[model samples]
Target chain A: MSYKAKFRVWRGEGGEGKLEDFTVEVNEGEVVLDIIHRLQATQAPDLAVRWNCKAGKCGSCSMEINGKPKLGCMTRMSTFSEDETITVTPMRTFPVIKDLVTDVSFNYQKAREIPSFTPPANVQPGEYRMQQIDVERSQEFRKCIECFMCNNVCHVIRDHEENKPEFAGPRFLMRIAELDMHPYDVADRKDAAQEEHGLGYCNITKCCTEVCPEHIKITDNALIPMKERVVDRKYDPLVWLGNKIFKRSSSKS
Target chain B: MTQTTADSPARRQRAQIKERTLRTDQWWRYPLVTFIIFTAFLVYSTWAIFDTSYFASPYIAPYASPCLATSCPEGARLFGLAPFGDWYTLPPGLLILALPAGFRFTCYYYRKAYYRGFWLSPPACAVNEPHGKYTGESRFPLILQNIHRYFFYAAIVIGLILAWDAVLALVEKPVGLGTLILVVNAVFINLYTLSCHSCRHITAGRLNHFSKHPVRYRAWGFVSKLNAKHQQLALISMFTVVGADLYVRLVAKGIVNFPFA
Candidate 1:
């Protein structure tokens, strides 16, 4: 007997939505995403789900499968019990635009607020010199795919809507931190980070880090150092004095 | 060195070499190096608290009346509403700040690094005197270090308050140079704070599968760089705070001017 799988896919627009069930034939080597596409082609035309690169690389297939945020393309149908109902829904955190599509424009807006790279005055474009060791430190943060899975799972924004305006969320902050730690980038956004981006609101529960599919050390490498730097600037007496002396000396010279 | 005949000379030589190795390894067990590093941190932290005036200085140039209690501008205030009042009042505040940094320096991650990279072992355990082994309680105090999450939160809050103070100085007079320095200091603080290991772990926890995206790979690259010399920055970050604090204080005290006294 050929195997059949049941899929309850969310279908509708905006706030109005309902799950429509469709049973699709499955082969041994097929992934869940493939099955969804097959259903879209044969069972439900205009199914209205977003996907790019059947491979997981584009981060376009992010959705909740059976109550878990996952890349649809990566989840294998074989993992589920043959008779179990596979429920597919759009990510819950963001506002749904249409069907599985969500409005992730907020994340992009947060990205713009972060301080961009500013090389030191002495560093020319071509002649910029950074040790292999120094560049290696910032390399990990550059890997972020902007999937916002970390953002989605983050309780700061997910559970608390009030935090949305103030908080930059974990992924964006990690991006800012990545640029900040870059050996050649001289621009600093620490003040903006605190007031505008809401760096202080994160209680460091590590929920964002735990959900990062990239396995990036979001809490340890990005958030903690940013916090430490903030503390150092806020409280360290010597730095305060040095800034005073330097400011004085520079004015005279 | 004379070899005893109770065993072969080669065995005796091997024993002697092993003893020498043990003695060399035992040197760090004396608690002296740890004490020295701790003292150095204390001295640096002390210097950071009192001698510098970054947090307490006025925004204007040639700040006169260095000793006056009310000399501080609104920008120099610590934690928004609280003022240190005088230069002498900062040491206790600094002591409170330094405690966590010092404790975190001896965290499990650092402990593992020290054991493997530096080959340093803990001192003799209190309960295991007969075995002459270090079998101290590892669960409680180490687990207690988890409070770093809370400390991280506090650091962000305090850092913002300081940044706000810096902004107040910038807004009050709009000294271009002072503003630039203040901005730079603020940026460094945010960078250090955001790059914390705890934050990374928390963020990474949400990700279910990461094999598809190339950007995630790049993020790991950035994280690895910060993780490599985290210990060094852990120390430098503490010093940078002191440096920022001193800048604020000296300007507030009228011991120095914005441009120069």
Candidate 2:
């Protein structure tokens, strides 16, 4: 059941590029990644594309398919109409290296900005106990594969590149939120998420959640809860009065 | 894996390099204008708060109304201040302001508005921000913004207070244009307060199932409808708050007396 499928892949380097069309053979159960591989094999040998595992786990095949941010390996070919021209473009937010690959250094930089998990003094590594409820909460955020699809679809920094410095995008913000939620982690992440990570920039459009190949609730579970935590500390009058009565009880001064 | 030769007519060469990687257009203009407008509003509000002449019928000035201290002029104290006694002789506006300010400051929409407008942390899309490193609101002062839900609750109470003020505006048995203005001001304030992101969340955040909590679901529905125009409400409330304060001030000062009583 091999069929010749059409693909319009943006081919270029250093930012300037255009969609170049090609027809490649699609096998019975092939995905976009298979057709991209075929495009590499048959028509354009010099065509540059980044992929690993071809099983969607690697998250290496991230690109905009028909203007939608998605993992090429995960996006089934059957989703599109047979006669439809499949448009595969490089992720628009970052600088294009060549063909479908774009420089994803922005995400890496944001990752570095976040302070890593800090266990409490009493709890040694592998000795700490977490309630199942607490464990499940962190587990939900732990499912992220760093696909950058969430990053790509995030409108906060996606179209707004200057916002890159301020906004940490959805993924890293969620990472901070995850660390804050961890039971044993004693560090005050609420402030860090607010001041350093640009947590305020996310408007909860849920585009990140929509594009997540991992199906993680990036908005509802992570971002919104993180927002709520910020509210609890800052605006809660009881907390305000408590701060006045018992000053500096916590590590955060 | 490619058997095809490296040089092929079918293989299109990548496009020429772009001169500048990012947008070259004027992206900073919008945020800059927003910055200017908000700054002006802050200045005007600060000036209005200090002006002791803001009272007309002791009910005219919304900002100074329910003035709790003994120092407040005749008929100004809606209630006496027993708890915060002798704290200061500052206008009740100082005591009353934090509610609406907190609501606006921590507002989801205002967070975005000010984050871009004042911070210039990007200012707008594709435009480089002034600062090299952005730490974000997870810190001490900024983390306080998280209490927006609490502020939402406070704003609702404050909105009720302002609405009461509107009712009291006509209690002297005078039918004047001031009465209409005060009523409209209260309406806008309520619109803004009810349309808050926290209000929307509070209405539905606790519910596991909408079908289980029909009332909250309906409340959320109304809040959502208002939330859609949240931006308009934010601006409208701002104008009304300032307008109501200024109107009372002028009338009390005998500067622009619109006599109907």
Candidate 3:
């Protein structure tokens, strides 16, 4: 059965905008993005919204749904009652370039800071061998679709613009953790993760983990385990004595 | 641009430029206090490290524990090896000071304190920081902060040495106010060290099934409790370490003398 759905979407640009209300037709088995499209086609054709891959794969439709970070493409209309008013806003962590489209240059800068995968000199690209367990460990972190929801939800930069400089946020830190966990990749990322990537800023709030569409155990598997590795290399006395004698840095390949 | 079906939609219009919020409350108070306190400690420790004459028989200064050099007093010697001999010309206090210093510098709680206090990295939530760019701990010297856990092991050994010194504070005679203060100092150091983030992680982290490792789980619970009071312990511990040094310094300088003798 077709029903009228109420949506409050924020519109405008240059850091100036407002939540404009619209009463749109909601079709059966349709998502929030579909309703947004309907509003664009039927009512306000000039309404600006960013989306691709309506299946939620592209992560381009990321926005705040009812104050919660969510993909418009994944949120089904069935989740809400017919009388509900869904409020959608642009991602808050970055500068809004237009309605629903934010300039995610902060994420790009963090990505650039992370040193690329440094392979072992002993093996060529195809000759590299790794255990299945090692691959699985890194594979879990690979689920990130660059949605930036985790980044937007993170309090480090979400509320505090000043912390944006130091904190690499959850998304990129997970990337560093992934590479650090990769057995075939030879680089000492432990120090870099804390010193460069702002791993220390993370208070283990797990907000990023909660907002992750991929259900990645970002806090438990990646961040916490990385913290453990740092402890092993930095604070353990045996490691200190060994390093003093062996002259090895904390770079675990 | 989307066509407005009517002049304006039925929602709230944002007429003003939306920038980051500036917290209304005196949010600077927290970080300001933190800044003053940490700076005071740093200055005190620097002075305490240089003044090696702070030892009055049997009461070794907390900073100068395990005085393993030739310049040490007969009673101050914890072990007899100043590897470089005469080349190790500095006071014994400076020798072992780096361990505890490193431990505190990389400490998770202290990191927050200093990040907010010293660097003004946001200073507090909802307030803008001074720096335009943040490279985090990924770069050169800041990356060394990752070695905090290693410092924890060092702290354990240092704590043990301090405990021995506290016991030794009364070696000349047990019934003194000086001995009492030393005992209290030792307790504070132990609490702070045990409550460390690394200690908490070592106690319980990386365990998927807590039911199987019941003993580890139990240890983790205890550490977690301590971890909760880490910030408070960190402050108190800093005070006690400096206070212990101050007491010994005053005694050595002929200002503080107990009647226990």
TM-score of each: 0.50, 0.60, 0.60
The TM-score that candidate 3 achieves is 0.60
Of candidates 3 and 1, the better by lDDT? 3
Q: Which tens-of-lDDT digit does each residue in A1-253 have in candidate 2?
A: 7777778888865556677889888877778888888888889887788888777788889987766777888889988777778888777677667788777877898899888888878777779765564445558888888888888766566545567777888899899877776766778887677667777666554567767989997876688767766654544677557667878433232
Please list the residue runs of candidate 1 whose C-alpha ends up more than 4 Å from where it truly belongs after superposition.
A235-253, B1-261
Model 1: per-residue Cα lDDT over B1-261, one tens digit each? 533233333221100111111111243343455456546656865565454443443342111111223344454334333333556443334534543454345343444333322332322111011222221211244334435555665556655654664576677657644555555666655556555565443333112122333465457556546655565655555555545555555555765554532
Model 1 CAPRI quality: incorrect
lDDT of each: 0.56, 0.72, 0.75
DockQ per candidate: 0.02, 0.09, 0.08
How does candidate 1 fare on TM-score? Answer: 0.50
Best prediction by lDDT: 3
Candidate 2 lDDT by residue in tens digits, B18-131: 321233335567688789889989999889788888666635577765576666765566644433467677766788788778788888667767877887554654333466
RMSD of 1: 25.1
| Residue A222 miss distance in model 2 (angstroms) | 8.6
